[model samples]
Target: MKGDDDASVVVAGVRVGSFTRDSFVDRVLTMARGDSTRVAVGVNAHVCNLARTDARLREALSTSTTYADGQSVVWAARLLGGHLPERLATTDIAEPILRAAAAEGLPVYFLGAAEGVAERAAELLRDRIPGLRLRTHHGYISEGDVSLVLDEIAAHGTRILFVGMGDPAQQYWVENHRDRLPAAVLTCGGLFDWLSGSNRRAPAWMITSGLEWLWRLMIEPRRLARRYIVGNPAFIAAVLRQRRHETPRRTPSGVL
Candidate 1:
């Protein structure tokens, strides 16, 4: 991965890389090359919104390899003079990571999303990347059933685990189970839904203009109105305030 010279601030002790999608992928791939396990967290508007008041959640988010998931974050980074090129949506990242895994013969496990979504996503991935070794466990299982899911992942010898249980839940799962699992996990929210065609993504133009949230609000107005309209702005203000109170820090040039 090419080194980025942009400024980086430490949030909850995690040194987030202020880089574009390609650089972020390179950095993640470099982390994948190491002996120790590494986990990556994709922070979208919802997660960022949650991170504002939840200090423990922020600390957990800081522990993983963090990437900008919402265009708002990309814009904020640019405003902070980092120049992040594009939003790295996990729905998009999933394809590239699966392609890379297929090429490297890595075993991947899909965890989360509604009952058939993960399975359908695995099927879609196989169609996209022939001969890909992938396993999946649906996200609708009860909390009591988590043990069985964990056991299945361990049995499959999963190298990469793509989690799609949404924020806080996905992050909490990864944090609690990271020590027990042998695989490197990536917390991806609703990615399976998008991949399975259960949830449609907004048009590219809307996403580019950071109006994807608006599109989502239009689709699920009652459910998403407070989140996008009210929660997002509050989160942005919190991030800016945090940035103002801190100084940029350098991350070690190696895997987590």
Candidate 2:
């Protein structure tokens, strides 16, 4: 909130902030140390495609500080003649974020994931990050009964809240409750699974070569097949169409 330079790029109609991992963590901590409320969200190809038709999700993203969580999204930013520092996947950067919060003595909350997943993640993080004041609640609560969870969060005096309910649901919850939540709220899809050791990250080579999607597909083929097979192609096509419609800029020489 304090150091937000408002630097961002629009890719396929979704806005993503241009911040390196370091800068991003710093900004979120800054917000956590502040009195004002803010929200952070990460956008991937699946999120972009979903936002194409989900007006509420679009609004949620439009109002939050958005970042590129997908390598494909970073690639699309470049293709659109814009630049994102790099992909800042929440799982990849969770350590630094949590460490910073711990260092700052900020109380943090982890809300989402299966019944025991969040609690396990908090336990591991507490061991890894000493002085980390963290709490958790499973994401299985009924939508209409979120007030109880909100009350628990407020009682903890949380300064940074991470929600891993996934996609539109997480974003929707943040948007609907932003006013009531204090400090910084971030939407972290599947982060709890990775942190709790229920899921593993792709191998370094796959991640570096941007084949992590393939790895994820391999690991959870049935659950993610449509998302990768269909969503990936659709995202490419959408960016291509956006590229085709844009008029190219000209130099003084007027060479075309």
Give the winner by TM-score: 2
Model 2 whole-model lDDT (C-alpha atoms): 0.84
Off by over 4 Å in 1: 1-3, 6-15, 239-256
- TM-score per model over all chains: 0.86, 0.92
Q: For model 1, give the 10-residue run with minimal summed lDDT.
A: 247-256
**lDDT by residue (tens digit), candidate 1, 50-156:** 77677878878656677767777766655544554567787777787777777877788898887778899789889879769999888887879888888998788
> TM-score of predicted model 2?
0.92
> What would the per-residue lDDT of candidate 2 be over residues 95-175, giving only the tens digit for each residue?
999999889888999999989999999999999999999999999998677898999999999999999888888888787
Clashing pairs for model 1 are none
TM-score of candidate 1 relative to the true fold:
0.86
What does the lDDT come to for candidate 1?
0.72
